[model samples]
Target: MPLRPSRDVFITCAVTGAGDTTSRSDKVPVTPHEIADAAVEAARAGAAIAHIHVRDPKTGRPSRDLELYREVVEKIRASGVDVVLNLTAGAGGDLVLGSPEAPLPPDPAGTDMAGAGERLAHVAALLPEICTLDCGTMNFGEGDYVMTNTPAMLKAMAARIRELGVRPEIEIFDTGHLVLAKWLKDQGLIADPVMVQLCMGIPWGAPDDLGSLLAMTANLPDDWTFSAFSIGRNQLPYAGLALAAGGNIRVGLEDNIWLKKGVLASNGDLVERAVAIAEAMGSRVMTPGEVREKLKLERRW
Candidate 1:
């Protein structure tokens, strides 16, 4: 397929992820209030969507608490932020093996496994306009850790998400995951205007090189709406690449922390940079309403 650049692009800021980056950068939001503020800030900076993940206020660790998510959602709603809320449903599938020799008993502390319903508890309660769906399981990083999302789990979750009338941003870490997404659509679980996030540069997943990115975009169905991002330094650079690939852009503190060599970035800063890059490339940054129409999202509130 030839390179067809995007003319109207939407930006999704993955505000704060469920990563161990709080200690590394003070900019990572921990409390519910902080996360909501980050989302609002990103919205003001021209992001069409805010992808959220809550954290333990005291420990700064990732959390799946319903109350915490409630506070964040309520705060953002109360703030009158017009950005589309995209809550994460990717938290409860972490698995860490015990050891190479003793891999039977997985480490309880590092492993967090839950059923489809339990995993998407917050989404069921809050009814965000969009939520993520990890299409397949893979080794997330260097360790016994694996991001486990079985076909059964994804099918159940996708069915429930469809019933809720929320669009699923299928998280594609590798090319195989894209195949699984197609299968889900074939199964009639994923509906029209399929949205996908081509997550790149993560260890044990697809590399951040241009060749890998082109290969991923080439396989995508023409009708599907997609976005791509690479972590670390490539995160900002991928803004141009994504535009050239005829997809949207994703950038925020969740993917990368640095604004420059020694600068730590907030969600808003990353989003501002993305807007500038998109505009520089002669693409218009879409608003929340435009994105909703583009994705055919059903906003809960």
Candidate 2:
């Protein structure tokens, strides 16, 4: 894909992800109040959207508690921040197997598989403007674990999301994932002007390189709206890269924990840095209202 150099771009700040990062950094928000506060702060720092995932307040472990999500959404809504809310429907599909010899019985502690409706309980309840649909399954990290989202599962989840009148942000971890997203669109499971998030540089997934980014973007449908992001050190660079590629940008603690080496970053700090990068490249950072208009989002709250 050519570098189109967008004049105006929107930023999505993934406030807190369903990851084990809380143990590594003190800034990771674990409680609902903390997550809501971080999301509002990111919006104030010029993020058009807040991609949120809640964790167990006491244990700091990723959770699928509907109450937790409800609290977070309620708090953010009450704060009156004009930010698009994109909730995660990517949890509850973690499949951790036992040793190769004992793979038949999955690891009880690490495995968390749920039905489509169960996984989307919170999204169905809160009716956020947007929710994510992880496009495909993959070996998530260095382990016997697999992030399992079968085709049937995805179809069901996408149908429910559409029925609820919420836009599904198709999250692609690799080229194949993008292909699957297109297939879903063709099947009419996904709506028009699809929104995609090209997630790069996670273990066992697409590398965060210019060539890889270009390949992913090049394959996207012309009418689709997209954003691209990479994790850790590559996060900041991808901000300018995505804007230059005529796409939007995403940044936050969910993807990276640092503002720089040896420094932990808050969600606001990441959004602030992304805003600077976009502006330096002569691109204007868009507001939530602008993004909602562009994406045709129906804000249920």
lDDT against the true structure, each candidate: 0.94, 0.92
Q: How well is each residue in 59-169 modelled by candidate 1, as lDDT tens digits?
A: 999999999999999999999879899999999999999989999789998899999999989999999999999999999777899999999999999999999888999
The residue ranges of model 2 lying beyond 4 angstroms of the native Cα positions read none
Best-fitting candidate, scored by lDDT: 1
Q: Give the range of the ten consecutive residues with the poorest summed lDDT in model 1.
A: 292-301
Model 2 weakest 10-residue run by lDDT: 1-10
Against the true structure, what is each candidate's TM-score? 0.99, 0.98
- Superposed on all Cα atoms, the candidates' RMSDs to the truth, in angstroms, are 0.7, 0.8
